[model samples]
Target: MHPSFTRRHLLSASSAGFGMLALQGLFGAQSPLVTRRTHFPSKAKRVIFLFMQGGPSQVDTFDFKPALTKQHGKPVAKDSPTVFYQSPWAFKPRGQSGMLVSDLLPNIARHADDLCVINSMHTDHNAHPQAILQMNTGSFAFTRPSVGAWCVYGLGTENQNLPGFITINPEFSGGGPLKHGNAFLPAACGGTPIGHGGGGSATAPEKPLKGIELPFMKNARLKTEEQRRQLDLVQTLNRQKLAADGSNEALEGLITSAELAFNMQREMPDVMDVTKENAATQEMYGIGDGKPTDQIGRACLMARRFCEAGVRFVQVNHSFWDDHSDIFKGHPQHALETDQPVGALLTDLKQRGLLEDTLVLWGGEFGRPPLLNKNNGRDHNNVGFTMWMAGGGVKPGIRYGSTDETGARAEQDKVHLHDLHATMLHLLGLNHEQLTYRYAGRDFRLTDVYGEVKHGLIA
Candidate 1:
């Protein structure tokens, strides 16, 4: 028989594997979920992102365009027969700031003094999948780490027992898991999804979170102590295999996920149960068994609980704002479902003194166009939109940027998706340029190689 090659020879045959093992050994001793210091001191310790999946009409929601209304039914251009459509909802000044907000979101309008609205937001794509991908991952052409993943990677979690990032009721389409995925980052940094948002129309009734369970969480056969013992034995064997393999990113990820799952089984059930909250609190969020606001109310309330418990990022997804047709019927219904809960969430966070340090982001993939289709609905417009940020060091009650008179494109102080990511990182005390992960022979960041932090938005 031929002599077997030594371990050194095996390593020499795979230098990349040897290097990976060395890198893992240098950083793997501590749990990746443990809290880490930020690049600088920042007021925001957590984030609660309210994602209005699909495009929400900026002209109908926050961006008041009297020009579009005045020119209603008139040709969009000198020669084109296509005409502009006015927003059906009325716009009125709200709160101390006198910011104009559409009546469709009256509850949110009441908190205008607390909001910093950015009207000239644009992205690269008009399509749902690409636009949503760019909004979440910063790239439409390539797979990349999500904004939530980057936040968790940079700051980790204050609560070691829970996931660093959590996403509630994520949609199954329009980029799906990639919207919250942790590509090229540590597996622990990815958003832990709770319930699923069935990909349906905006008017579809949202399902309640009554018996949602973490996949494979409950063990019917084993007692708690027995389960622990079994886990320990399995982990020990996994470690042995890891040692023998020298380097296996997949195996390492599996080990970390398993440990987190075990820890989550001990604490997540209690955290997810919103019924424990008092009646007044529940009523404040508009939470009821079969109400329009019930789904989002529960989501927003759960977001607060998660943030209060020290999760680094929590995303609450409300879906089907893609009003391509019958927008008159769709937008109002969608608003009814989310408006009160979102307003309540902000109020609740403020009352608990959490909003000051917890950043709240609200918007969607893009905005609807000013021109109306034959179906009386607006088409997708990637040119201009509105998104709002409150608390967490942002200047309150301010309106920044603007679209053109027709609202066809961003006209002034336009903020691109990359700039948004940069600003978000900056608010979290992370230098966007410095927060990079070395992968595929290059350093990858949430904003890619492009981004300029908009300091004016910061308080």
Candidate 2:
């Protein structure tokens, strides 16, 4: 109806549009996760990030320092400012691999052979907000796209209906949304956080995702034909906008998101309903059970379901590891809540044969120091920490890197935060240097200008 419109133009446009319709139908049926090709053959098809909030003490958890234990309550030298602290829990070898694990986490120790512990991990910041931001976004100095956002941008999602990246019970404190935000990336690549566990716990009943239920339409028994007509009207306006500006990537992503949300109404409810699982299975995740284990278990169980459904990235958070006082009491409770569920998640994934292509990563933003404070607790230390990985084409039953005699800093095979990002991207078949998004007249990447994939970790 514009002044330039003509009968001949309309006919010609219609012909091309009809052909485009056929192509759209074919592509639309496929997952956006598979929309792009990997730079190389990928070892991992998906990623599950288990975020342990509040820095967990390395010496008290996985990093066993025999010298520190022997020199408990002693200083490095006469009049030394920092006093040494030892773990109350005993460390013993577990599994056939003889991986050292603390008695504090007996359940996780059971599967020691599957873990690839990295003890020499170092980050830039020591503060909670900065460290948490760096761990999630690869930067603390500026807002940047989160690792989950990067994964979805590079890999897309296997499930066309569900969101590509989901963060269950993401904590609200510290860096909060900045830890999961997409920054300059397309908004659709950002993580969808379900439930609020940000206050340091996931014990509350999970609030269903906004706009998930269409109660009004459901009660009215809305017909498919009627829904299609309504959607067509919306698409008509969107198409006009797209036609006006072909460079509108944001609008393009919005159109795709709207379509995905519509399709999700048909499938998500079923996938979220863990009640359909057998009683034995429910018990495994400790859903109906009491205390801290109950909520974290549900979160872990939900992660498995999402992974099976082809979600590219699923983040399950367990929090309040910041034990500045009474670590003896605080850390044990945190471990009790997380250990059973984490062990169960690993076992279930392996049994289902999903572990081979699904990478499971576990760690906190940083780690606690070996120096005990007046409150009988360790303070934050960014120089050296510990993290572990399982499955996803990594060699199992191995410990890579090491901390100093007192577990104060990385003594050998040091891996910086950027290196960690690079390795994870490599596992997913993305070249860190090449996987970039241009914004503000400059190219940006998850690892910025620095990163080297630790090929030694890969199988």
The CA lDDT of each predicted structure is 0.83, 0.79
Error of 2 at 256 (Å): 1.8
For each candidate, give its TM-score against the true structure. Answer: 0.91, 0.88
Candidate 1 Cα errors over 4 Å, as ranges = 1-28, 77-81, 196-202, 206-215
Clashing pairs in 2: 33-156, 33-157, 171-198, 172-198
- Candidate 2, position 89, lDDT: 90
* Global local distance difference test of model 2: 0.79
Q: Model 2: residues >4 Å from true position, as ranges?
A: 1-34, 75-82, 196-225
The candidate that wins on TM-score is 1
Candidate 2 TM-score, C-alpha based? 0.88
Give the clash count for each candidate. Answer: 0, 4
